[model samples]
Target: MDKNYYITTPIYYPSARPHMGHAYSSIVADFFARFKRIDGFNVHFLTGTDEHGLKIQRAAERKKIDPQTFCDEISQTFRDLSKTLNLSNTDFIRTTEERHKKTVQHLWNELEKNDDIYLSKYSGWYSVSDEAYYSDEEISEKENVKIAISSGSSVEWIEEESYFFRLSKWQDELLKYYEKNPDFISPKSRKNEVISFVKGGLKDLSISRKAFSWGIKVPNSQDHVIYVWLDALTNYLSALNYPDTNDELFKKFWPASVHLIGKDILRFHSVYWPAFLMAAKIPLPKKVYGHGWILSGDEKMSKSKGNILDPLDIIEIYGLDPLRYYLIKEVSFGNDGNISQDRLEDCINSDLANNYGNLCQRVTAFAEKNCSSLVPDNTKFNDEDLVMLNKFTDNLDLIRTEIDNQNINYYINFIVSALFEANKYFNDQEPWKKKDDKDRLNTIVYTSLEMIRKISFMLYPIIPSSIEKALKIFNLNIDAINLESIAKHDYLISGKPINKIDILFKKIEKKHD
Candidate 1:
């Protein structure tokens, strides 16, 4: 068992400000990274901006600024977002960065050296918005304008002398690789789509764009800039110091554990990325998980749609952890999910305030009054007590299995169910009624406290700040959290003083006009 884990959110395009979709991907990746870290793996988490593309060039031109200047300003918003969202990413690499440029050019030279690349002329329908080349079958005319049928984004005919990657040559090899490693593309549905597309056919890819000057230059071909997808995909490698494959960072986490991406880019990551790695003689990532979009209403969030949900606004209203919890628990991973304000408010009030927060506050307040604010000593475990406590120890392995499979919905559902059970257990036992029987009262308090510790440990990855506050009732900090400790029934010290914590969540009151 290797304990090294590497994960990445697709480096975002900086043509627009960060959106809920960007935040969702980063938060999900951060959740996995945090889980792996607490599970005893050395984790490397990467995210950043894809600053070079036709869309970015046009956006910069519209702003009346140079591409680099535009990138610097726009890219900072993403960096700020990583902080605002409380992401635990280890590195943020921009395509315009010199180090990333070095890695991209190095990959290019390697492909060229391997005869996987050739100088060629390309004529196709190109979508500047998607930064993708579409085949005739993929394009449809809408309102007298040609658009990519899949994305609904307008495309233009382009003819350019450029460099091409031998994607067609690797078509059969890629299919064989996918067949050999069935889990390479996740969620079963996405895998089927990729396999069917590859089986249909693969065209040689255009790897350079002579029209855009805002990207990494082809190694020896100064007149051409590398294709945006190729340059952007290389960020995963560049962040690890590739080309110097023997470097410690590169050697330990080369083949990434997973690349978390949006479904719209599934073709690029699942097909082109793996093919590029194979052609360059580098190991492919373990998995490419293409998650669904975060829809604003019934439609996917887009600027043109005027329905993009700003995560920052949601965080402002509900708080970060609540937002994190809502997204993680409510959204069905690998399926498009809509964000509704009413549902978010309900989640914050029901799940956060009533269930988990009330449990922590009630138990701690009871302990303060009855047990002198100290962790109580239990006399003996009753069947009921053992049953409640065993829920965690029993499912430890199952939780780990689900996390490994990226079964986020399962993991979150387990937590929600556990929280519900913990609340019910506390209510049923009636510790306040057994005040005269000190041992029984102490036992119930001890059991309740232990349940809190276990559930808080499981939740540390999702609602970290709130969990940090909740754990302080046990006088524990972030560094004290560990997944392995959850299996221990008596992890909390008997005589340790429990600190008081502020309300974890203020119930959002409903308004009646």
Candidate 2:
């Protein structure tokens, strides 16, 4: 049996329509899931919406309808965005679904059974925007500036009947957890903040709210709806049929490998979530990475800024792979960065159009012209040939490591760099000029073509469709692109006829109409 690997994006809030940020989060998760599947893991990738929230209730009231109907409509918008992006998630969990409710209730019972849950009256600062409560110490005022309990957003006041989690008691245990597993939180910066915050102090958090009826109802307690954060977080396990321990799906994927989320909600995943799991005597997730945000020109692309980019806008213009490549290619995955059509166009022009697309076209066309429309083989190896192929393969191994680590910025350039080196070798060897020396020229052309194959395999995860087109030009089958096969470097039979190839990535010229 294969290893089980589960991953999830944060359940998006259905109050707002889907945007590029949402797509970015889901796509990151989708890519990792696909890569794991390709690497032979039985992967469970989940993405979905948090249908029960105070904001959903307000949005519904503003639209003169019940929250469920409102959520259904808004949730579809997210689902549509996932499909539009061709995300490969295995399941989509909705908070309003029966399975989710049962799971949430089951978790509540487990915590209660463990004596970690209790009824109490709550009075404190609350941010409906964040669906989080805060203490006076956590909030601060600096000359008309309102900072969050931490960084992402601010907390405002709520007084209601509620249940509390024994977070304070687990602070030392959580610290030990961080000590024992330092890689639990990623990117180093997030890890530091989480450790410092947990060391500062821990407080019992309110787990239910009574102000609204738009959330999951507390078991047998209609007056108090489950807190949106807890209810939303439960969607992760609930989708996999949790609480039914004998169920194959639940047993297989109970402890997720990675729970990817925005930097803002790092506390929920890093803090609240682990405590909940500990209380239930369940194992914590292996890793939780909070990726940075996408900023627009001079501001973060947010709903308030009216600059939140729509993925459709880009997909319609350049298609999905181009946009996907530009996104992961343009920014280093762990850090925050800016994006614009101008930058994306620049990447498409220089990197895609010039380097990758040109290499494929040149190599395939050369093989067709001189090698009688046939692919050449590198069965014979000289020192020069061996050196060039060694350099290319060295870059390929490094690229494989970078891709696995999600280091996108330098990784894509690694491909371009190797191609540049290969281009230089071809130019210096002058394969086209040595038409009479069929064997020597064939060796150069064939080696260059093999480099192209390696680059395409490295690129397959980032730009699948574009790579597919490039592979089609080589007449390579799906099996040819696998890691084991790519490593073997035996793509073309010595005299296998090759097809004529065109540009994989077209140049984007400025057309002022």
Candidate 3:
């Protein structure tokens, strides 16, 4: 049986348009999903919108449209983003869907049966923007209005009949879980934050709201609606058709390989989501990776601040591949990365256009001119040839290990450094200067082409479209590309005709104001 690898981006809350932050999280998930597929794992990638919430409800009211209709429009934007970015997600779940409603209700029943739920009159400060309750300690006065200390979203005091999940009951168990599975939360810092929060003690969480009618109805209760977080997090399970444990997808992907999310929600995914699963007696996901934000200028991008960059504009200015590669390559996985057009262009021109792209264009253009546009025949292995090949072969395990660890920046930098070394090798060998010795020239060019081929395979996940074009220059097709194909040297068929030379990336001329 193929090893099942399930991954998910946090289902986006589509009260607003998709921004660079939304794009970053989804793209990272897509990269991991694509990498797993290339590594021969059966991958299930999930991304979608969290369509039901007070935020959506209030936004719809302000727009003078019904909530469902508003949600439909905004949710489609997320779907369009997935399509535009070439995400290989298996499902795009929505909270309003019948299938997801069923799953949430099923989970609610399981928690209820376990006595993890009870009704109580709730009076607390709630952030409508975050759709989350804040404790007295988590709230503070901001301009005379109570605000959530963490998110800075304005909160209103409310009293209502609500159903509460016994989150406090599982505090010790959660601590034990963290101790036993130290890596349950990623990036070390986020895990420490979660552990400290849980140790401070968990209060019973409000699982249902009587004030909002736009969300999933609680099982056996028409007046109460399931909390938006519960509905949203259930998307991971609902995509696999949970509640039917006998179902193939449910059994195979129940314990997700990873849940890719931004650091802001680490507490929800790491603390609440796992507690909910424990209440339901379902297996918790293997890892919850809370990646850092992509900032604009010096501050985090937000709609209110008017600093959010529209990903479509970025795509229109620079192609999708560059944007994708920039996020994964330039951004540290667990730290904030401030991105700008200048920084993006610099990385692309230096890394892709100058290094990777220049190597391919220079070598292939030479091959076309000298070898009659054909992959030259490599003769007996010389010491230089063996050393170059060894350099390419020796790093495969290390790259794979980094991929497994989700060390994305390390993985990307390793490939780039290898390409840089290959370029250095070409320069040192001086293949062009040996033109009079046809056999020696052919050997040198052949080695460089094979090294390019190896780099092409490794880079396919980050820059698939460009890599596809690079592979085609050697008359190679996408179907033949895989992890094992690059394990040995010279997988490219010699004497195969090279396609017309095409630059992988065009150098960007920076614009100054």
Candidate 4:
């Protein structure tokens, strides 16, 4: 089995401040990276900003600063966000970096050498906001303005000298590759969407923009800048020091395990990216998972709509872990999910405070009071205890499979159910009433402590800070966590002193007017 895994969050276009959608993608990628690491895989997780585009140039001009200065300021917010979101990304690559520019130019040269890129004139509707071109069919007139129907971004007809990638040449090859790798695009719906778009017929993609001075200059031409998407997508390879495929980072983690992107960019990743690699004779990433938007009410959050939700504001009121847990558990993966204040509060109260947090606090407190603040000794498992413990051990393989498939809903549902069942076991076993039967009391406390240990181990990726606090009862820090430990029922040492834990989550109080 290949134990090396590579994953990425799309290099964000940092024309503005970070928003909830950006936080969601970074958190999801971090969840996977942390999981893979705990599962003993050498994981490379990459994220950064796509700094070259007309929109960025325009935004910088509005602020009366140079583009690089503008990028330097905005890109730092994203880097700060990775830390805020607790991402485990190994590398953060900026397209403006010398290393990335070198890689993009190298890729362009490879495509040019293969006769897959040619000089041409581009005259079409282009959305500077999206940095994408729209064909006649994809554009619609709205109140006298041309707009890309998919994104509702305004487009203007532009005619300029350009270099084009022969995307049309790879249509059949892309379709065949899709047929060969059924899992290449996830959730089935996104895959079908890509196939339908490709079958509709692909046109040679405009790969250079002569009207902009804010991007990497086309190699040798010195007149046009590389198209933003082409320049942006190569960040994945550049982070691994590509063009030096023999480099240790590239050799270990090339052909990324997955690209976690928003659904709107499906065409770029599923279609153009693979085609570009096919032209360059490079291996394609194994999968592209296009997840849905984080909506504000019914509409997707966008600056023009004036509906962008600042994640920092939410983080201020509710700490990082609750926000992280809410996004992963509340939002159904691969489908648009709205972030409601009511729903978020409900999740934090019921799931975090009442279920998991309560279980940990109750178990540790009970052990401290009854078991002399130590791991209970001489645990004798009955059928009930065995059944509760085996929920995790018996399904370890299934859990691994679900995570690999990015069936995050399944993994979360399992944890939620386990949390509920563990609570029920404690209530029914009535450990408080077992004082006269000291032996039975010890067994119940031992089983409940083990339950807390296993669930916290699995949840370490989602809510690290809170779990770190919870794990102190065992003297285990973050480094001590591993998936394999969940299998051993005796993993907690007998008669070892256990520490007390404070409330993991405080219930949000509602105010009555």
lDDT of each: 0.92, 0.80, 0.88, 0.94
Colliding pairs, model 3: none
**What CA RMSD would candidate 3 show?**
1.4
Count of clashing pairs, candidate 4: 0
Report the Cα lDDT for candidate 4: 0.94
Highest lDDT model number: 4
By TM-score rank, best first, the candidates go 4, 1, 3, 2
Candidate 4 lDDT over residue span 321-380, tens digit each: 999999999999999998887778888899999999899889888988899999987568
How many clashes in each candidate? 0, 1, 0, 0
Worst 10 residues of 3 by lDDT: 478-487
Please list the Cα RMSD from the true structure of every candidate, rounded to 1 decimal place.
1.0, 2.4, 1.4, 0.9
Q: Model 3 segments beyond 4 Å from truth?
A: none
lDDT of 1 by residue, 163-214 (tens): 9999999999999999999999998999999999999989899999998788
TM-score per model over all chains: 0.99, 0.93, 0.97, 0.99
Q: Write the per-residue lDDT of candidate 2 for residues 1-513, one digit (tens) a residue.
A: 447889899999987787777878887787777666655678899999998877788789989999888988989999898888878788888899999999999999899899998898899988776778777877887666554646545565777778998899899999999999987998689999999999999989999988888887888788988888888888888998888888898889878888999888899999999989998998898889989887776655666458888889889998898888877777668777677778788888878888778877877788888888778766776778777666655554675556445566666676677778777777788887888888898888888887787778767767777777788867875445665444555556787767766678888985656
Candidate 3, after superposition: displacement of residue 339 in Å?
Answer: 1.2
Candidates ranked, most accurate by lDDT first: 4, 1, 3, 2
Look at candidate 2 and tell me the lDDT of residue 130: 74
What residue runs in model 1 are displaced by over 4 Å at the alpha carbon?
none
Task: Assess candidate 3 and give its lDDT.
Answer: 0.88
